[model samples]
Target: MQDREGIGKIMTETGKIVTETGKILTKTCKIMTETGKIMSKTCNIMTETCKIVTETGKIVTETGKVMTKTCKALTEKCKIIKETGKKMTETCKIAKE
Candidate 1:
């Protein structure tokens, strides 16, 4: 009887160990799934961010071109105004004489 009880106890302990191992494996599998999901989300975010940065760069380039053209136009207008002012002064001086 004593030997039988010892054998039964060992079998029960072995079953418990197997159950605990199975639970640990299930938990590890869940953790791996969650980690994969997080990695996928991070990659998506990075891809979107790169696209935004590329679009912003294009906008900045276009804006720079527009600003350069506007600056050149203003410079030409200022030169014209200065020349007109000088001509008007010359005309006034001649009339005064």
Candidate 2:
């Protein structure tokens, strides 16, 4: 009779362990589902960030083009001023002679 009781107690303990393991597995599945959702959101955010970077690059390129045009205009003005100075010096030399 004592042996039978011992066997029954062991079976009960094994059943309890199985039930606890099932609960743990269910919790793990829920955690995995939540992780998948978070990953999806992260991908969306990354895509938006890439688009912003592309737009900023376009703006920078346009600004560079405008600056180049302005620089060319200034260079042309400098050349004209230099030529006028040379002509004035020639006129002064002639007047002194």
Candidate 3:
């Protein structure tokens, strides 16, 4: 009878260990799935950021070219205004004399 009781205790202990191990495995699988989802989201965000950066760079380059052209046009206009003002002063002086 004592031997049978010992055997039953051993079986009960082994069954508990198996149950705990199964629970641990289920938890580990859940964690792995969550980690995979997080990695996928991070990859998507990085891809979008890269596309935005490329578009912004292109816009900056275009704006620089436009500013350069605008500056050159303004400089030419200033030169024309100075020449016209000088001619107007000369004409007024001749008329007063």
Candidate 4:
């Protein structure tokens, strides 16, 4: 199993975003917000770190787009994502948005 628990982790489930000060320590741990995604290398936000409230590969934000690998359909977790009228790929939108 993936090691979700680390030196500063308390979560008991997978894909649970960690909001600790320094629990997150990689680029894969994305920072989600209303405006867009911040690929924070370290846990820098005041209270957010790798914190995806819903599920993995899904984001909670306003005016955001989280798409699938085909860039055609939005993931179920991203179905509510406001249509910014931007055609998005999962990786690009997550990084560029």
Clashes of each: 0, 0, 0, 0
Give the Cα lDDT of each candidate: 1.00, 0.98, 1.00, 0.45
Ranking by lDDT: 1, 3, 2, 4
* Evaluation by TM-score, superior candidate among 1 and 4: 1
Q: How well does each candidate superpose onto the true structure, as a TM-score?
A: 0.71, 0.70, 0.68, 0.11
Off by over 4 Å in 3: 1-15
Candidate 2's C-alpha lDDT?
A: 0.98
Q: Candidate 3: worst 10 consecutive residues by lDDT?
A: 80-89
Q: Per-residue lDDT of 6-82 in model 2, one digit per residue for the tens?
A: 99999999999999999999999999999999999999999999999999999999999999999999999999999
Query: What is candidate 3's lDDT per residue for 1-97, written digit by digit as tens?
Result: 9999999999999999999999999999999999999999999999999999999999999999999999999999999999999999999999999
What TM-score quantifies how close candidate 1 is to the native fold? 0.71
Clash pairs, model 2 backbone: none
| Model 4 Cα shift for residue 40 (angstroms) | 16
Q: On a 0 to 1 TM-score scale, where does candidate 3 land against the true structure?
A: 0.68
- Which pairs of residues collide in candidate 1? none
